[model samples]
Target: MVVSPERLAGAPHPLLEGLDAGRAAAPAAVVIFGASGDLTSRKLMPALQALMARQQLAPGTSIVGVGRSDLDHEDFRARMRRAVEQAGDVDERAWAELEGGFRYVSGGYDDGTTYKVLDEVVGDLDRERGTAGNRLHYLSTPPGVFADVVRRLGEVGLHRPALGGEFARVVIEKPFGRDLASAEALDAALHEVLDEDQLYRIDHYLGKETVQNVLALRFANSIFEPVWNRRYVDSVQITVAESEGVGHRAGFYEEAGALRDIVQNHLLQVLALTAMEPPVSMSPQGIRDEKVKALGAVDLLDAAEVSAEVVRARYRGGWVGGAEVPGYLDEDGVAPDSRTETYVAMRLRIDNWRWAGVPFYLRTGKRLPKRMTEVALQFSGVPHLPFAPTQAAELGPNALVLRIQPDEGITLRFGAKVPGQSFDVRSVSMDFSYGAAFLEEAPEAYERLLLDALHGDPTLFIRTDEVRQAWRIVQPLLDAWADDPAPPVDYDAGTWGPEEADRLLAADGRRWRRP
Candidate 1:
């Protein structure tokens, strides 16, 4: 197992602590279902290359691309290499090491012939490359076909753990399902084919370094955890704002509006991470168990409360980041009368001892003011400010923000006395940047997650219960939106969300932090 100095630099994060943290991925057949898709070209290829560059993937491990495209192994490798090269400079030696094991099988996901062919290819790799029959199947295909892919693999006898305790695992991408019922059906289908332990439900947000650092900030450090509960924390804000419009994904965006697309997976996952109780240990199940519990504790809103608690809106044509963007309705392929929401803001109450009354405000929208993904905790104001009203008038509540992208870091806001001023106090932020703290830049989210998936570490991945619970929490809102006559409220692009969103906070005598 080779670990780049960049990853081993400084103190390792608490989440990264474990006996197997540095263990390389075992020799296995790494098969990707949608190997010709954009996710493969843009994300998966670069990530695999990075792992290869770091020598994290074991020598005998192989990648078998199973796609519908009619291309031989060499053509597939060339196409993927081009994408990896475009993403960044490739390590020629690592590329050579990885390229030899690359194979492609073109066939329909539902075709039994495809699985038989894939089985033969995998068997050959096991014998020739010493993969030892271990397999890691990544179902990168559309959610609609996930069950079929798994079932086909099962029919070909690829679902069972490989010989000699070598694992055979599958990774599935989300919108695990559109709603509660669909999610349950998908889970049942998957379970029928393979055990829960064999499936990895991936959400890239959980792979971010900052997102993982959240654990270190809470459980590893003593300062933050003490004030992390309802007694000291006033509110929690989780925002995943994107500056770009739907662009080429308007067709997909139309079907999975903000709630299903962002809220159900990314936002709720982050929320669970932020609010979850300290796990007894850093084991995969231990951490994921706490996350699932946190989501379960989120008070589900009734149909009646959905209207008041959740605000769904679409972005209208306007300037964003100084460039004009079209409205969601004007986006190509989007229906003119589409009620799909581009922005959603909701006030969630976690019904747990730790966060009983404290609100968790969640929001994610396309074409907002800027691209920012973060979780900010606003601590309650001081019990009593000793300074005169005029002295601390400008001071705001203390805040600890975990910035998940752009500039990945944490910022703690507090009040400070002004120098040479007469009894005046001002708010100040103390920042910790991942890039500055460590000499190396943090790996991209996909890179970290892909490495974890290959290593069979499911800590950063969503569990089955987590997915179903998230859908449960948001299902009422989904149904209410369907029954309502009015369309989603509209807000101009490049601005903050709709005015109604602001009022959502104002009604509680608080407001969202612009950051």
Candidate 2:
């Protein structure tokens, strides 16, 4: 658990100084519950390997993968090696070091005997390696099995640390729930097995470097905060767009539409971060308190409001990336008459003093034009313009954009005079790209999140109250859509979204950004 002074002395960046400040986590066992899933292979395993490569993992750390698959330890290791290879470039030495600690335990979710076997396996690791009774359980399984796994952990006394021992924490992946009632039920079940501090509800989007930079951009700089309120800002648009269809996930998509899969968790979380008041400090609870407040202040929509403010649609067969793709109904495992929505756009208002009059527009979709997630703050135009109308016709309102993916960066757009004697102006962007500014590529989101969980830092992880608040805001819309007999409107696969999405913004005299 002790931080290596030698390692800290060789730190390459100021942001990594925390590594030398005795903040590095102690050796522990990270037991993943759904080890056979794609999430484990694609993200979790690769992240663990990268952390080892960076010497971020403790010397005696171990990973025990628990799943229903019949694979033994060696079989699991081989599969993971291939996964890590596919993820990125791999260092043989680092991969070998991480592989040495890999183990697998095959078992069913509801079998109490399986947990008993797991308890024994974890104890053996504590004795063989210097894990010191510290364990991190990752619930990467389906939501239906979340409660069963938590209860089994509690039943086997795996939710708590051994007497006078180190820590025990659990990391739960989303979707946390399908609706408000389910979310509340899950929260209640979690409380029975583990204390609030011992649980980490992970949303990988929050783990991104750019998303974290949002807080830094707002609080660290003085220029934006003063004018960030309703008085100077016109409207805010947050978009999480993807160009690919559901593909293999069509079965899950059939039951959980875009609303449940994306808007309820990721999109709402981004909105809270964008609109929250500055925290007293950046402590775990300090940041979460402000986020909860912001979410609580969200203007909940009623049935009437839902019809006016929300637009839901499905993607029809059309060319994407210059290739034709199947519509939602044509996807395998999807019902012929499925009503699930692949695209969603909604307008929200915060009922707080700081953002009273301003609107926040949020949208997310699958099978769209491109893969990009960003937050755009469009500033109100100048009240008076001294320039001639013809000279300023091309000028648009100033905007500050925080791009979260693809080209991760911040862009400030403003009017600038063209190269001529005449007073002509055009919109220009001043860009700050992450890749250009830093020499090292940012760590994967899973890497950051896993390290934080091991270090017992929940600042980046969502809290129980935050989850419930997000569900509360989206539940009415879910109900309204369910009660209506009409199916979701349709849009082409390669297009941005349904025409109704445009109308949703046009009604307020605004337009959706081409991005």
For all predicted structures, in order, the TM-scores are 0.96, 0.95
Which candidate comes out best when scored by TM-score? Answer: 1
Q: Single out the weakest 10-residue window by summed lDDT for candidate 2.
A: 13-22
Q: Rate the local accuracy (lDDT) of all candidates.
A: 0.88, 0.90
Best prediction by lDDT? 2
The sequence of per-residue lDDT tens digits that candidate 1 reaches over residues 225-336 is 8899999999999999999899899778889999999999989988999999998777888898999899999999999999899999999999987787888888999997
Clashing pairs in 1: none
**Model 2 residue 477 distance off true place after TM-score fit, in angstroms:** 0.7
Candidate 2 on 201-264: residue-level lDDT in tens? 9999988989988988997667999999999999999999999999999888999999999998
lDDT of 1: 0.88
